[model samples]
Structure formats: C-alpha cells, structure tokens
Target: MYEVIATPFLEDFLVMRPGKSGGFKIPFHRYQELRDTAGDRPCPEWLAAATRKAWGVELSGRSADAVLVREPSSYGYARASYELNLGCNYDCPFCYLGKKEFEGLDWEGRETLLGVMRDAGVVWLQLTGGEPLIDPLFRETYGRAYELGMMLQISSNGSRLHDERNLNLLTQYRPYRITVSVYGATEETYDRTTRRRGTWRQFRRGLAAAREAGLPLRLNVVVVDDNAHELDQMKALADELEAEHFVYSNISPTIHGGPEALSSQSDEHLRARKPFTGCNAGITHFHADPFGLASICKVGRDEQIDLVAEGVEGLAQLPPIADKLMLRTGGCSGCALQDKCGTCRPLAKRYQEANAPLVSYCQHGRR
Candidate 1:
C-alpha cells in the first residue's frame, strides 16, 4: 500500500511503490510537513488529510502511507517508449530508423502487451515511431493503454493527427502530452527537410487542431542542416501558437554511423555537446520497436531483445551499459576528445564502427 509522492518545487522524487506514477506535487512547506509527520503505520492521518486537502483526492481507504524517496529503478521502470508503427508518409533524409518497413502488433496483441507492461510496473508509456498515428490500430492501442492506468505520451509528425477523425480519436483518449516534430517553419524549408510537399501546411493544421481541441501540445523543432537556418522562426512559430512547451533537437545521427548530420550541426551546438549530460536508458527508461523488440535506448535500438519472446523479463537481462560514458576500446579510448566528443558510442557500435573518429564533430580538429 505504500505510495510515492512528489513536490512541485523539487525534482522527480519517487517512493518505493510499484506501478504508481508518483503522487501529487504539492507546496514545499506542506511537503516537508507531510514528510515529518508520516510514520510507519497502517496509514498516516496527517498525510492522508494533507493529500486530500492539497490534491482533492480521498486516500482514507488506502492501505499504506506514502513517502518520498529516490526514484525507483531496475525491476520498476517508470517510463517505456514503444514504436507503434514504422509507416511514415514523409521521408526525411536523416531518418535514423533507416527506411523503416511497416510493422505493429494487432489490437489484441497490443492490448495484451499493454497489460504485461502495466503489470511489470510501468506507469508512463510513450507511443513513438516513424509516426505512431499512421498505424491503423493506434487509436485503439492508445485507448487501451490509457485505460490500463498508464500515463500516455505520443511523438508524431502531425500529418495524420491533423485529420479531423484522428484528432477526435486522440481527444477521446486525452494523452498526457503530444510532441509534434516541426521540420521547418516555412513550406520550402519544411518540404526540403521532410522531402515531402504539403507537409508544412499539414503540420500547421495539425498544431491548430491540437490547440483547438485543448490537447496538451509540445513542439520538437528537429534542427537539421536542411532546416538549420530557420531555427529562430520555428521557435517564434511555437511561441505564436502558444504551445505548452517546445525544445530544439539537433543531436540526431544518421543510421549508418556517418558524420553527414554533424556537417550541418552549428558550432554553438557542437560546443554545447561538450557537457557530460548522462543517459538514462537501461537504468530507468526503455524502448520497444514496432516488432516487439526492446532496447535500452534509441541508440541501442539495433541491439534489441525480443520483447514478444522474453516479455518484460527480458529487460532484466539487457546489458547494463547505460552508465558507460567512455569507450574502453577504439580511437576514443583515453583520447583527449573528452567532453567535445560527438561520436555516439552505441551508434558507432551499431554499424561495427566503435571508437571510430568523427572529424565533423571533434573539438580536437578545431583545436
């Protein structure tokens, strides 16, 4: 009966509860008071009252008291990313999924899979892909996941999502959030980046539809060489639309471990990559592709474990490489590239090119 709680002011805090998406984020003093007052008992009276008062949820009948602790790991994964389908209408030159072939579980199969993940202690599930909404079973699959008490997030290109039918379907399930990747701010740039005519207009239409429906909408401005010049316009567009949130992403790599994507990466962006921002893949995050193959992260997508054959238990058997920051072999081993190394080790290893040098992203070359 133990529950996890979070405070609005603090970072993500977790209590040792299973399958619960952490508790409400209340005020600071109130959070401290609840922590101080809570005791090991059937349930704390003050904590329950505080929660009810703060979040307007009655927890009196609940069996166990809630507590704040470090976020859970290992057996309990808080979030899982699923590639719903590999079918995408627009073909971007820099696609990392590598000319994805259409694949997805049928409705019954997806339903069973969602149940398995929920039972395995996953509370937040992100539906992503070449384009999640393109799949025929996406709506039903999303609805089933939400009904299973899993907080749902979706990553989309906004093509089909702009359709009135698809918008209505998404509105029905009411996802926690949806991220629409904006390839470019203008039609020319957008078309160039996505290599598809009419996508920019469709993207705008989708954004408008999402906003009108009051669905939580965020923007992912995929900054690539093709659309690098319009980064400011993209941000301005997001601001004008009053999106819930927006972020820039230029770190995506080519599928074959090439530095072509890096060629267009800005100098500022390269310098920004100098920090050791760690990865949270196998540690607390996991990704499963459309074929029911699970990987530690997007970079490790090729190194997949068959989720259908092994189920969630396969996650336990996955290699614990999430913490690895430095390559033990290859040209990068003990090299002075340090923080400025833009070579993704997983991506390098994916194409049998581990420790290979990438001059386009190396600070050593500039030095």
Candidate 2:
C-alpha cells in the first residue's frame, strides 16, 4: 500500500494522498525527478519532507514502491463517475434513475472495470448509485478503487452511513468527500418523500455517525413538492452539521425519458440555470454505469461504449460521440435563443421525448 500518489492531472502534475482532501501541485521537473527514481530505491528526501508537511506522515526510509505510487497515463479523462449498482433501499419519487434495479457486475467484473478506469487516466472518481453504500460489493469495490490511487467522492442518501462496517471502512480509507442528499428536515416529511418509514431515523443516524468519524461531507438540499416547505429547515440542518451545502431545485425527466419525476418539481423553488457555456464531459471526463458501459456523461446516454468488452481503447470513441450529442438538433436546432439556452442538448432531448411541458426546459416555454 502506498502513502502518496504522484500523477499527471491533465496539463498539471499532482501529489495526493488516498484519504486526504486537496494535494500539492508540483512542477514538471519535480515530477520527472520522482518518476526517474528507481522504485526499489529509498524514498527521495524532498518527497518524504513534502509528504510529512502535507499529511503529517514521515516516509524517510521507505522504498519508493512502498511509500509512493506513480500513475502515468496516455488517455485524457481526469475525472469519472461509476454507478456501482442502480439499487436503493428507499424509493424517492424524484429519482432520475427511474427503475432502481439491484443488479450489476460481479466482484471479478468490478475489479476489471476499476482497472480499466485507472488505465483510462481517471484520477478523480466518484462511486455512486441508487445508494452505493448498500451495494453488496461496496467494500471490495471501494477498497480496490482506493488502492488504485483514485481520489474518491461518494454520492449517497446517507441511509447506511451509520453501519458499523461502513463507518470502519470509510474511517480507515477515507473518501475525499461524501455528498449526501437531504430530502426534508423533519421525520414525517423525510419519510413521506422517500416513501419509506424509518428512513428519517436511519438518515439522521448516518449523518451523525459520519460527522463523529470526522469524514468530509457536503449536503445536497433536494427541494421537491413533497418537502418544499422544509427547504429552510434542511439548509439549517446542513449548517447545524457544519457541512458545505448546495440547493438543487430543478428536477429533470427520468433517464428513460419518462416525465414521472417532473411531477415532483417544486415550481416556486425552481431556479433558472446559467446558460450552457459548454463542458468537457467526453473530452475530459465520462460516466460509467454498473455494467461498465461508458457514456459521455450522465445525461447523454444515447451511444455508449462497453468498457467490459472493449477495454480502455473503447474510450477513444467518446469525444466524437460527445460532439454529435451536443449539437442543437431536433426542436432546438436553429432556435433563436440557442446561445442563451440553459439546458444542454442531450438533456433537452430527454424532456422533448418525455413530452415534458415547455416551461420545464425551454426558454420558449417560459415566454
């Protein structure tokens, strides 16, 4: 097991620790020096000093192979999100995933998928799902990703954060951050929104345990009609836990192009998003579902590459797919407000397919 990871991050170089947030950026020359050092040699003095200063750990006498892992890649993607499985313990009416099927790759397949991600140059990885913490292979998958030197962020509903096994694992190999969703501040509202009794107690316990364990956390206030009245209280709850928070008011159609989730949108709370200025989804990052199918991003799933079959080489097809998906075709093509449109092409297509009201996605509808 290595204590630090030295890798290339797009155009820059970074030295990061598995469980720590933020890392030291080093010049090309310094990275070269570390790369040139033989793995069997003692840790470089400068690296030892820097590691101690950055993470309060001394690596003076350890071999380079034991104290550090150098990750070099030819691919371009630097960040990615993997859905361990599409299963959940709670059934939130507003879930974009729609059908929450509890099925995914087995342990062997998952290990192979993680390796493929590593080879594809994914340094910042997010492990998510309907609820990733509850995946049967969550521990194995998480531990493997950590050992592979990816800085991880977990997206969850916080229902399982209180589990003794989960807490122990997370504490030992900490994630950079855990983003938990807040549906409501009170038990009644929370349980009602998730359509599960006792979910409120479980969520509360999970948050408390994660906090006590000193894990980095961020809260996403999921505002919906069912819990819109508790918006302020939800924000206050985040403040009470002293976690960073974000408000998510806009709800979208389900991934399968169903308008069901749109019914839960809190109209008053829905805010206009900034104009789409473009993103580096396929060029710099991508998303992987449970079956190891890679797409440009979460929203644009029209064309996918099967990583399980094609391996890292399959990622080469993404940039072109992304270009095609981003064009404002269909109802958006040649629209006068194309430049000022807030929704991206792929997402807009979903709303159109679902027959979602124009107000939900189009500037024309707002008029």
- RMSD list, candidates in order: 6.4, 1.2
Shift of residue 51 alpha carbon in model 2, Å = 2.5
Per-candidate local distance difference test = 0.65, 0.91
lDDT of 1 by residue, 115-234 (tens): 657655676789988888878888788877765556678899987777877787777656767888888888999988888899888888888888888887788877776777888998
Error of 2 at 244 (Å): 0.2
Clash tally, candidates in order: 0, 0
> Which ten-residue region of model 1 has the weakest summed lDDT?
8-17
Misplaced by over 4 Å in model 2 are: none
TM per candidate comes to 0.75, 0.97
Give the distance in Å from residue 231's predicted Cα in candidate 1 to where it truly belongs: 2.1
Question: Which portions of model 1 miss their true places by more than 4 Å?
Answer: 1-74, 244-251, 256-271, 319-327, 337-344, 347-359
lDDT of 2 by residue, 89-138 (tens): 99998899999999999998898899999998899999999899999999
Q: List the residue pairs that clash in candidate 2.
A: none
Error of 2 at 7 (Å): 0.6
